[model samples]
Target: MRQAGLTEALSGLDALGRIWRRRGVFAIVAGAVLALAVAALVLLPVRYLATASVIIAEQEPGANTSAAWAQKVGDPADMESQLLVIRSPRLLRQIISSPGVAGAVVSECERGRLLGSTDACQRLKTDVGAFIDHVESRFSVASAGRSRVINISYQSGLPDVAQTLANALTQTFLEDQRTEGANSREVASSWLWQELKQLDQQLREADDKIQKFRRTKGLMRGANAPISSERLTSIGQQLSQAEAARAEAAARLQEIKSEQERGPTDAPSVLQSRTIADLKQQLTTVSAQLASAAGVLGPKHPSILALTREQASIQQRLVEEMQSIAASAQKAFDANTALVNSLKKQMETAKAEAGSATLDEASIESMVRDTEIKRQQYAELYKKASELETERRVLRGSTRLVSLAELPSKPFFPKKIPFLAAGMTLALIFGVGAALLADQLGARLISPPVPVTPEAPAQQVEAPAADEAPAIVPELAESVTAPETATPPPERSSHLPSVADVSILACLPRLKSLREMSALGAILQGHQPLAIPRVLRLASEDTDFQHALRDLVHELGLKRSARSQRIVVTSPDAGDGKTTTACALAEHLAAAGRRVLVVECDVSHPAFAEIMALPASPGWLGALERGTPLRDMILPTAHPSLDVLPIGATTGPVGDILDAISLDGLLAGLDGYDAVIVDTPLPSQRNDFLAGTDWAIVCVRSDRSLIEPAVVTVNRSRALGARDVGIVVTMTDVEHRSPPVVQTAPVAAYAGAG
Candidate 1:
């Protein structure tokens, strides 16, 4: 179905092409339209525009300022924070209040308000939303390409305004950035100071609490020490050893000291005391290092493991050293104590060694030296902590701005030329469509033309020969006469006279003689004589009219006969004009003339009188009706050249009339005739008159028939037969110019008479 539709569409397009070709004016008109369009386009001026670009640099948030949190929140939230600060009432107010910007904005706002309202400054500030709005509005900030740069461009009606706005925007942006940054930095610094101070307080409080806790819990410097089962067990074993050693050393030392206090022998006591003190001090150092290592390197550390190993090694060493020291102390104490004990035992022997008063004062000086060493270590650590805090405070002050916007040099607006072109093009298309629509709706002319064929020519066909009688021909017969003039006379008219009358009068030709008139009228009626045989037939069926017509023909001597009768039988009326006269006249004239004959061709209404008249071997109608030899119709007449015969019975309901072709045969059979008068029916009322004849004369009535009817009768007879003949105009008025004379001539009899 679709394919059929497409085929039809293509056919329609072909037909449309034919239509367009025939109506080539349409194409010319369309071309003219297009040409005018091109002309107009050529006439239009070209326009140019200048452009400039600006970049919007993205300012990343400070590293420690929750930027990661801002990203998870999306750009709008971050941008809103940025936008709020940029478009903040205070900031917008600040821009509006700025040096030059304030006056310009106030003037613009006043102009705007003047165009709208009356309140000045109050309305001005309210309308100065235009400034914030202008930057946020005029400034188009879009992320350009795939980069982090946002493009910010400003456009205005004027290029200078565009440049000014661009510059102003860039300046505003820098100021906004700087102000925001400085404010932000100041706020951040102040916040940092507050927070840092609070945190410091917290730190000091934590330190104080930790210190107080350490002091209250007796955990002084070894607070991080582990007290796992294995370490505790090792510590317990070391403690037990130390305690045992101390107990033994104390026993020895006590014995020595007791001896020193009781008696005066102090060397052994002092040495024992020094050895105990050195051993105890070495043990304390090892214990303290082990605790420190345990605090520094928890239970899982290699250092802790090393500490444990070292502690174990130290425990053994300390035990051995303490035991060795204690043994030496014990020996000294034993020796001194034993000596004292022995002296006590020998009470009197010990009494002599008791002088010990000088030793106590020097020992007091040694105690004071140890107290000085502890105070110096505490002072060093406190000073180091203060320096670290001061460094931290200064590191927070340094901040910098990294991005800046530059001013643009052009506006991005109007685009008037392309817009106008588009509008005009659209308008032209619509105009063409309207023209086509109007053309379709209006009436148009239709042309009429003649048809043509390849085979046939264009001339009109010839009508029938009978119809051709009216058609004019220029020919003459010797038996008749020539036309006196080439053209006919015009009738005179009495109505509105004009020069047409004079032209008509000038073209009329003079009349001719009666004989000439008769002959020429016969010729004009379309009868043409083929040869110049001097015989005539005045043939008709009616006798009286025929007799008169015969006398007229004889007076004219149209034929020659012995009896002086050359009758041309004719009619004044049907059956009234004598057909018998044709026979009688022929018989009378042929007495002196040569052979004469009567031709009978009125087959439908035959009036041969073969029964009434004398019978013959074969009659004229017998020869004609049977289509037999015309020689048989040349029966014996009284005249020589003339012939007389009677018509046969009616062959059919109508006469076998002669036409152009059949007349040829009828006339061909009359080759021997000097005079052959044919008897026929009346032609006016009955059409079988003069069916066959050599020449004919009409037998028209004098009173009853008009000359015009008689003339038409003569014309009609000439049309049917009588190629060379004349009208007798019988029974014409006696006052006519030449009255008819009753005369007869039989040329056949005339030949016989000679």
Candidate 2:
């Protein structure tokens, strides 16, 4: 597990190293990209910005103008409305048509088109609409942070132009607001004046109608207040008073009459008579004189009698005046009673006139009140009209300017630090992307396409050539041969494929020392080939490698019990010790007394002739061309029961020699061999040359072979009739190298599944 993990880590490192090595390939191109980015940042036009702010004050109570319709300050809706007014097209058009604003926008456009071939700048110079659009695109209006202030901002390449345009827009907005306000006031005044005239006419009609109603109702005016039903009530009250006065006078007169009936002097008025008072005073004076005379003369004196007579006369006159007073009182009582009756009839007449008129006193009173209300309304309308007329001349809008735009000292955009930073970041990304693209294009240009084999129709052998050998039954062919000399031993810690799909027949250890070979007896299990017979002894050597090799050979014999046992050996790529593996397996079987043949079909880089130290000759090919017996072509090997058959003369790129001689006939000639092993080059390259073999001994270079291509080769071998395949992994230097696994086991079985 540790070894496999190390192998994956090493593979990842190798991939990274390959990528790192290509870093310099695109460095110059990437630097040019960055340089262009820097130039763009430096050469692009800079723009200046200017802002003007205005505050929208809250409306005061009791105000009656357009300003009064405004909401309180600090309200979002109110702030938004102010911004809307500033940004309105009508106001914007006025600002755009300002004396210098349009010219500045055109100039900016002309500057922007300096490098272009088009006459857009020339066209815009004469067009106000294009200038206005440009101005609007650069201008911005927004409320300032939840406040009632609205900010008007403008951007331009020229600092003075930005400031002038901003100030102009703010000023234009204010003037437009004032103009609208004045127009609104004038309209309101006109409407109010017309209303006042109508109200005045209504009031006059109401007053005149009230008078006509009073005349029809017979409700006359009183001395203090108007006379209506209350007048009738007053008349009734007067009648009642007159009746009460007449009753009191009559009662006094009756008492006086009673007194007069009893005696003239008994009358109350006579008792209170002024004539009796004066006459009594005179009689007293006369009685005083008579008493003086009687005192001097006799009791019947003339002076005394005269005094008495005068007193009686005064008493008589008093009685007469009392009677007269009582009669006057009776006359007064009668006149008062008649006056009361007249007043009561007058009251009844007034009520009858009011009732007959079909206008009740209450109705008349309501009419009077309504008429007064009309007069009051007319007066109020007159006052409001006058006020609006005066206000129309002086009314200002709700918007007030808090500040005007100032000239900008610095450009708002194309700042040095920020632009450079942003440009650098973008250039870095594009540079890397461009570099990778260039590398890919270069690789595609450098490599050529490899030709893949097409699916050919099934056939054992092609027609014989001019130098042909006789054809024979391919099934009658015996198995292959082995080499005379020993091949290279399997390296240490060798990786082998799994024994599941393809049984790994052998996994030999590295023969680093005598200690490593001490357990050779156990690994060979008494079947050590004569090619490697001398076993060096060691002191207490580790035998784990012995168990591994023993287990491999045991598994091969146990698993490979089926028919069609002719084994073909190949690799996915070269340098996998393909020939060495075939030779070793054949040697092991032959030394065990099982007759084996190892045929070297790989003429391009054949190892069998070299390993046997063969003299230069045509090998099997020359013998066939010479029509020599097939038995003589079979060369003896160092192993008593093993033999080698080399591919003669070098086969051309097309390998046409194999077509001239019957490979099946040659194999059939090996009738005595117990088993056959054919050593060939990569199967994928040769295509399907060894299709007759039932099983394969595929060699894999441990820690180096790509499993995917190896798997492809194995699958292709299966398609070409090699079944019951076995793998022999070689050159595995696991003790010191990476990917130190014992075998190139099935990828899924070893990939963390356990």
Task: Tell me, by lDDT, which candidate is best.
Answer: 2
Task: At residue 739, give the lDDT of candidate 2.
Answer: 18
Question: Number of backbone collisions per candidate, in order?
Answer: 55, 15
- Which residue ranges in model 1 land beyond 4 Å of their true spot? 1-147, 181-185, 202-417, 443-754
- What is the per-residue lDDT of model 1 for residues 321-349, given as tens digits with 9 covering 90 to 100? 44454356766545444433433343332
Q: What would the per-residue lDDT of candidate 2 be over residues 619-682, giving only the tens digit for each residue? A: 7666766778656777876556777777766343435454343335557666777677787754
Clashes of 1: 55
- Indicate the residue-level lDDT of 607 in model 1: 47
- Candidate 1 has an lDDT of 0.42
TM-score of each: 0.28, 0.48
Off by over 4 Å in 2: 1-33, 56-72, 75-92, 115-128, 212-220, 227-249, 256-270, 274-364, 379-391, 424-754
